[model samples]
Target chain A: MRRDFLLSFAGHVLVVGIAALVGMSRAVRDTRRPIVFSVSVVSGGGTPLPQAGAQGTTLVESKPKSQAKAQSTAQSKTPAKGGGGSGSGTFKRQGLGVGVEGAEALGYSYYLNAMLTRVSDNWLNPYAGQAKVLTATVVFDIERDGTVKDVKVEKKSGDAAYDASCERALLVTDKLPPLPPEFPGPRLKLHLEFEQKP
Target chain B: MVPTTGASPGFLGPFIHAGPFALVDVIALVLMSVASWAIVLRKFRTLGRASRQTRQFLSTWGLRTRLGDYEQVAQRLRHSPLSSLLLAGVKEFNALRAEFGNSQAGPELLQHMIPNITEAMERAASREVAKIEGSLAFLSITTMVAPFMGLLGTVQGVLVTFMTLRGTQIPTLQTIAPGISDALITAVMGLVVAIPAALFYNYFVGKAHELEGDMERFESELTGIMRREIVSSQVEQRKGQ
Candidate 1:
């Protein structure tokens, strides 16, 4: 009986050891390769809009530098007629967006752009050369209070790291400035294609 | 799409939520549970039938004074170990009686018969125990493996959860909760299957021992009665002289 007890105890210890070993190996395997979330913004003015989530006012990444320069020059031309901050920044309507004119729309766009940048700042995608470019389309609701809610990935980047970064970007911006009164609607459902560039 | 290793497979979540390893754990648990349940159910019915038949045989043995009555009832009491033990003893007695050619067995004849009867009784007792014990080893084994199986799953789950964080910038609860929960499910299931098996094993052990004791006591009684009959016959022969 004593021998049996000792043997059983040994077996249990062995099991625990194996489990620990497996867990350690898995952890090592997983964390060894990191994904870096590289973010770029495209503003609607024919410039790449701000990353769906980023922080700050001057987060404009156009396909080309000239487009960004033109948008800046246009901002200088538009009077600071919009509410909040220096509303002097011009609203360049993105082709896909519903066109609305004037300084009020431009003010709303700038603030939204800034919020996406903050989200983008928190994102860290996996490293390059690991795989081809992957894109994750994410959708989220912006409440009237500017708190982000129900952020979901509508399209997955076939990589866990990439998809996770997309979700995290939206989540980090738990709160943003409430939509400007010039913008219609109590809540806004926003969609963006977050890409992991090769 | 990159599978979320951290999502809850939950009770009814789609298989896509769990990694292949976690899915295997769930399958193992389900299969083990089914096997354990089957063992418990079959054991209960076998024991119940054996107990009922044993009681009926005991009552019949008490009502009938003649060995012939036991033979007649033995067929109906086939499930009873006590009935089998009695039949073995009686068959030995009759064989001894026939060998003695109608003369009452002297003490010497009785002495030889006792050994033969003892052997037969022992053999029958073992057979009865074997029948009662069918599939019991499976229960014991299931008890031992249940916890380990659960541990395997839990360990795998924790491993998967940690893996989610590998090469990632930040670890969110969303990425961790699923693995943790999946691990917990296996551990819980293991305990659920194991506890009942252990309880039933102990109960079955007790019943088997009780039946074994009854068979042994009856074997001894058979010897004493045969001895008494022989002694009385010898006295009668001396009185006639």
Candidate 2:
């Protein structure tokens, strides 16, 4: 009987140890940022942002009026080039304008804010019962037209249901207000949080 | 009984945080508890009945003289271990008497009766033993498997705990303790279910063996009685001739 107890205890411990190790490795890998390039461009009439890369880019295309004023104020304090169209009103001219744009990009913040608002309003509230907090750093392209294209969830919510909800909400809302013309368009990191009420 | 104070909320509150695996383990433990209780109650009643009937049958057998009277007594004690043995012996005696067909007392007739009586007694012993041993195998299996089931639950709980810790800077005991606790509960439950089952199995087996030994002894005694009767009848027949 003593021998049986010992053997059983040993077996239990062994299973727990192996399971813990497997779980630990998976959790670690899941939490880390993958080292590969993951950004892609949304095709067709949707937000036409360039693919994300080493270069920082502003991706928000259509901003609400309040956001434009905030950008103008922040820009006035700094000596950097202002972000707006170069007066020539065409898609090609806007694209050319984006090529020369520097760091003062208000479009990225506006796009993120809009996405966050939508997430808070539509997805987060309805699914409070099933909500889980997830943090992701996404890379997307901002076409010269300030459209956010190809947003991805870099760090997924451990739960697929919650992650899918976040993804769907982002996809439904298209163009964000345009960034200031001087904003660079290489790759930008946006830290987003989705939280649910307890 | 005096009512005891209620348990503090936190006594088992920590286990709740052990996650889904812990919940599963708790459910399994509850099921095992119910099953163990059921087996204990059932075995208690069955063994009690068997013991009471055996004693009653033995007392009746001691007072009974005629074969017909013994047969009637056996019928009254219908599920008793003694009933089966008595029925087997009586059936064999009747079969032998019919086969002999009014012939004078002979060695062949007596030999046939003894072997038939022995064989019947053996068959009845085996059947009684099986009846008494019912549910003992289930108890043995529950004892053997409970620990492993508990371990499986514990492993699942530990896995969940470690997974929660992987990305963080350092895993602390506070973070890991609940998982370990959850896992251990399964092992505890396994032992709890197994111990009683094993004890009951052994107890029932011992009882069954004891009853079997009694039946074998009684068969020998009955065979001697029958032999004496046959010899006395033969002597009376010789005098009449």
Candidate 3:
């Protein structure tokens, strides 16, 4: 009887130890935050941006003011990016300018905001002299070590210089901070829209 | 596709940093697991001991040329249910014999004692069966409770996740994955604890029944042996006359 008790106790201990070990081992290196960038580019023309990397992305083309008006009326029929089942979702740009408003947001903004700060600080406005206001969407896949990969330009600003500068800014930033150990995956796919300030 | 180095979240990390409610689930899971393990171990030892005692007693007595004296056999095989039945039947037979050999006629005395001996043996066998079945309900309860504990963790995980969404935009999958994943760990743990308990409960129940069956069969055989002994003694006495 005593022996069985000891054996049972030992078995329970072993199971718990294994669970803890497995949990600890899978921890990610970078701090993890939910992706919450509310970037809505109101550029004219339906042209899809020049995607830099491999295919298979659903990009929302630059819609004219009328379509933007139409989309807002239809917005209620669709799922909100923030409220949807999927972890990754997109929302139409609300209001004017690059200000953050009209959103219930998590502390994750700290992480994404910090990343944006790093990218924007390194950027020299590509459209400074350009007469036409252009926007380019860039997708960057970041390694756990903070190294960036496949910095593809999803939408081209129609100006090579504008597109090149956005791509260069990401590359120059070099490495991002490592993800939190508890983050889901090893690689973080970052999508950013660079709009030329008119 | 080949997974790059950091693709898989370290499997161990989420559990360590899980929320309080998920942690509650973990506590329940641990308790159930410990309980199930203890029951399995104790049941194994008990059923195993009974089986060994029964085998030892049967092998020693079943092959004998003549039935061994019940007192000596019962003393040696103290734990066996068969031994207890044997003692009960023989004791009853002796009590009846002392009262009835008011006839000195052995046949009448034997007939009178057989029915009472069988009844006494049956009662002793039932008691033995109950002893063999002791604590088995615990195993069944453990099996039933384990899965519910896991589900409790899962519900807690979802609740916590949704609660976080109250003041925030719907978070990305990577952000919420850890909590949900940790919550699921409890469920997995519950199953881990329950499956063995369920299997062992059935196994031990079967063993108890088999032991009971052996005692029941042995009771009838004992009655037959006692009748033969009485008839043989009477025939010898008549020949001498």
> Pick by DockQ: which candidate is best?
3
lDDT of 3 by residue, B1-241 (tens): 1112234456554566567877777777777677667777786777787788889888877744345576887888888888889888888877776776445686667776688889999999888887888778878887898888877888887777667757654344544665677667778877877898889889998998889888877888888887776676677767867
Cα lDDT of model 2 by residue, B171-201, tens digit: 4333455457656776776677677777877
Candidate 3 local distance difference test against the native: 0.63
Candidate 1 lDDT over B1-241, as tens digits, reads 2323321233334333556776787678666666666666666777888888877767666633335466678788888788788788778877876777256445567666678877887898898889888778877887899888878877887887787679965444434654675567777767877888888888887877777776777667766666666666567767876
Off by over 4 Å in 3: A1-3, A18-140, A149-174, A177-186, A191-198, B1-29, B63-65, B69-77, B98-103, B160-179
Q: Rate the local accuracy (lDDT) of all candidates.
A: 0.60, 0.52, 0.63
Better of 1 and 3 by TM-score: 3
- Candidate 2 local lDDT, A92-190, one digit each (tens): 001211211111233334443333333333332223433343333344444435455676766664767656655554565455455444333322333
lDDT of residue B9 for candidate 3: 51
Q: Each predicted complex: what DockQ? A: 0.03, 0.01, 0.23
TM-score of 2: 0.49
Candidate 2: stretches off by over 4 Å? A1-198, B1-33, B63-68, B105-108
